[model samples]
Target: MIRSSRLLNILLVSVLLPLAGLSQAAGWPRQVVTDNGTITLKSAPKRIVSTSVTLTGSLLAIDAPVIASGAGVPNSRFTDSQGFFSQWGAVAKQKHVQRLYIGEANAEMVAAQAPDLIVVSATGHDSALRLVNQLSSIAPVIVVNYDDKSWQQVVTLLGQATGHEDQAQTIIYQFDQRVTALKPALKLPPQPVSAFVWNGGGKEVNLWTADSAQGKLLQQLGFTLAPTPTQLATSHSMGQRKDIIQLSGEKMSEGLSGKSWLMFVADEDTVNQVNSDRFLQQTPAVKQGHVYPLGNDNFRLDYYSATHTLAILEKRFVH
Candidate 1:
């Protein structure tokens, strides 16, 4: 399919531009009860530092005043080592947000920003406990566990932590409305679509399940995840058993089967890369020509990315 990015870019600007006022909804002396424990803010933080890149999308979506934002761990998705995902680059640049340390959250580098509040996830590439303990010396730290929560919950937590819960709700509501509006034009194949991301430069493929960025959005739109071949699921899950699964291209065709496929990539070039793989080329998606590359800033998705995902589906299937 051809790229139609201008449609969604215009949609995002029109919907999110007026949210600046929502960030000003201050709830002073806010006490957030997180998985680690209760951390209380002295006041609504004017300057915020987010140590988790996943949380950065939520923080920015709510219009919180973040001075610095950290990047995600390497290979976590489309995120990079710079502690910034290109998906949110526009907002980060507009706010003049300092790109903080990526990799594991570094206490010393985060302290340099001199932020009033620091936010992170309990489980991720970076240890939230470590950040809470180390960064607490500099400012208040709020840690949230996202293992069992939906993306909306994560955004709501950030909203409460930064006194922007209303803005968070507003954003989530807008997304819901858009999903409903797009429903009329959307269609799905008989079987679930296996949505995954392929890295063209590195030749790696990762399955996006219910717990992942793509899975969450597509499942919400009444689509099911592709059935993981019994053997692949066992091999991929191992002992821990997480929602998202990763596999090499050779094994990918064995695990994925359906009439349609939604592939996520950094650009169109990755599509060509996937096509060149003999094993990947054998899948039913390839045979039927149902493969579609997810457009726009979707390689790594978060709160803001969900809106773009909807836009992509609406344009692709909605006549």
Candidate 2:
């Protein structure tokens, strides 16, 4: 009787011990301190709501499903002009994102969704803080600031929060490898002064200097930026209007002369207008086909956006 009891006890302990170990391995920690704040994740968030463009892009990059998105702008509205959001839409569909937009987001709207986690970008705005606090009342809020850190760090932070740290790191590594391989193949010309012109119609063209995201991306691509004298003067002058003149047509061509020009036309009409303008047609870049027409949506500088741009450049420019 004693020997039979001993054998039964040994078998029960052997079977139960491994099951307990497995459970511990599968359960991730419930909370972590992020750059934004303390995040308390309850049972690996299954439903996520993303409010910022960067956060939404990151989530899609990792094949994570977003139950709700705050940026409700349709991809079609900007795709023809820029193509960034449209590419993201296809990826989002693949991830099964059923809920599209969170129109006029407020605490009430977020609370009603019952999300497992709410991800937002800290923009140093009072409204942003209010939204984060409101969302925290419903569930954990993880804030990420892409402007303050490297893209790899942003991805890793999101991965850690979502229980996919390993996947995020791998993606970052692969992105670095792609960049390294492409650098050698690039036959870049001498650094030329560049300007980004957006034809907003009615003879008003919006010109962006080195302060913009597109400008930063251009610099990364080895382009020199034009001097913004008005912007510089306004900083020193008292009660001076901080606005720069919007140049179009001949003025636009002249403002961007002496170097390759990149123009972002928002509407199809604007594109046709620029193509038909004799002054624009006579520019150096126009004659040489060096003028790159940026799609209306290509300005987003998130993880997916960067990756997509790399792929597009590789296909179009690199062999």
Best by TM-score: 1
For each candidate, what is the lDDT?
0.71, 0.58
* lDDT (10s digit) by residue, model 2, range 1-319: 9999999997886445333322222456656566566666766778887766446767877656577665544444443222225547666656755443433456666666788888877642212445776678788888776544555667667776787665566666666667777766755543475545454442545555554445555556555766644533233112321222355555666665535555553334555666567667776766675655555544445566667666655664565
Predicted structure 1: lDDT: 0.71
What TM-score does model 2 achieve against the real structure? 0.66
Report the Cα lDDT for residue 304, model 2.
Answer: 66
Clashing pairs in 2: 81-295, 81-296, 82-295, 82-296, 82-297
Q: After superposition, how far is residue 316 of candidate 1 from its true place, in Å?
A: 1.0
Of candidate 2, the 10-residue stretch with the lowest lDDT total is 236-245
Model 1 agreement with the true structure over 1-319: per-residue lDDT tens digits: 1246887786786667535445444557757887768887878889898887767877888899998877664444465445466577678878888877666778888889888998877765544566577788899888866544567778877888888777787877777777777776686655578887775443556676677656777877888787788777755333342545667757777766656778775456666766667877777777777777776466546676777777777777766
Q: Compute each candidate's TM-score over C-alphas.
A: 0.80, 0.66
Q: What is the lDDT of residue 150 in candidate 1?
A: 61
